[model samples]
Each structure stands twice: as structure tokens, then as C-alpha cells.
Target: MGGATTEPADEKPAVYYANCAEAKRAGAAPLHRGEPGYRKALDRDGDGVACET
Candidate 1:
């Protein structure tokens, strides 16, 4: 028998944005450090500002 697979309750699905414009369009802009959608790529300068327009 195969057991059912499940995700942790605290785990959130990743939201990918092609660029800052896309993220802003979705109202997910100004993402700070350690935020769910925040990534080093988004924060190019690594100043903890993600999706800054």
C-alpha cells in the first residue's frame, strides 16, 4: 500500500514573479527579507529589498 503524501501546515507555496513589475501587479511588491516570495535574485543589491520598483 502507498501512503499519502502531505505538506507541512507551515509551508507555503512558492510564488514566482518574472520581475518587479509582475510582483507589483499582483500586489506582492515591497517584499522584505525572509518573506515568503523574497529571493536573492529579486534583491539584486542584497539590501533586503525585493521587488522594488
Candidate 2:
């Protein structure tokens, strides 16, 4: 049987930016609703858009 695969130590964790500007500065802007690192906090209005500056 095959065992579960482990994540690489060098792999970085998902980053949740405080605002769209922050996410854009990190080159992770234009985030959609389901994209990684996208959080509801980023979408203050909760209109299915995140990190939209």
C-alpha cells in the first residue's frame, strides 16, 4: 500500500493579505472568490470579489 504524501518543507503557506493593495504588492492581486489566499475579510462587501482594489 502507498502511504500519504507529505508536503515539502520549503512549501509556503497561503498568505491572506489585509487589503487589496497588500495582495497586489505581493503580486497576488485580482483574486477571485475561490482562489487561494482569498478571504472574506478582503471582500468587505462580500460580492464574490476579493482583493479588488
Candidate 3:
């Protein structure tokens, strides 16, 4: 008798980051909430805004 083997699934989601300061040379506009840059720039504490506070 043959049995099928099952594999465990990945629990962690993929993460992305915004452009670095070096990339923009400090002249790039700031990112706001709900933006890609904001998602990468701000540090979340308990699912709330941390960097802005």
C-alpha cells in the first residue's frame, strides 16, 4: 500500500519595501498612509502608527 505525503504550508506573508533615501537622494516626496512608501517606512506598534507618534 502507498500513502500520499502532505507538506506543511507557509504561514508568513511576503513583505515589500519602499525606495530608499539613497535612491531618491533625500529629494523625494514623503509617503502617506495607505501608500506603498508608508507601508514600508512606518513601523507599526500593535497595528497602529508608531513612527509618526
Q: Cα lDDT of all candidates, in order?
A: 0.85, 0.82, 0.43
Error of 2 at 32 (Å): 0.8
TM-scores, each model vs. reference: 0.69, 0.60, 0.25
Model 1 regions more than 4 Å off: none
Write down the worst ten-residue block by lDDT for model 1.
Answer: 35-44
Q: Estimate the overall C-alpha local distance difference test score of candidate 3.
A: 0.43
Error of 1 at 18 (Å): 2.8
- The C-alpha local distance difference test score for the whole of candidate 1 amounts to 0.85
| Model 1 lDDT per residue over 1-53, tens place | 67989999999888788888888988999889887678888997889999776
For model 3, give the RMSD to the true fold.
8.8
Q: Taking the tens digit of each residue's C-alpha lDDT, what string does model 2 give over 1-53?
A: 68988889999887678778888998888787888878888887888778676
Worst 10 residues of 3 by lDDT: 22-31
Better structure of 2 and 3 per lDDT: 2
Between candidates 1 and 2, which one is better according to TM-score?
Answer: 1
How does model 2 fare in lDDT? 0.82
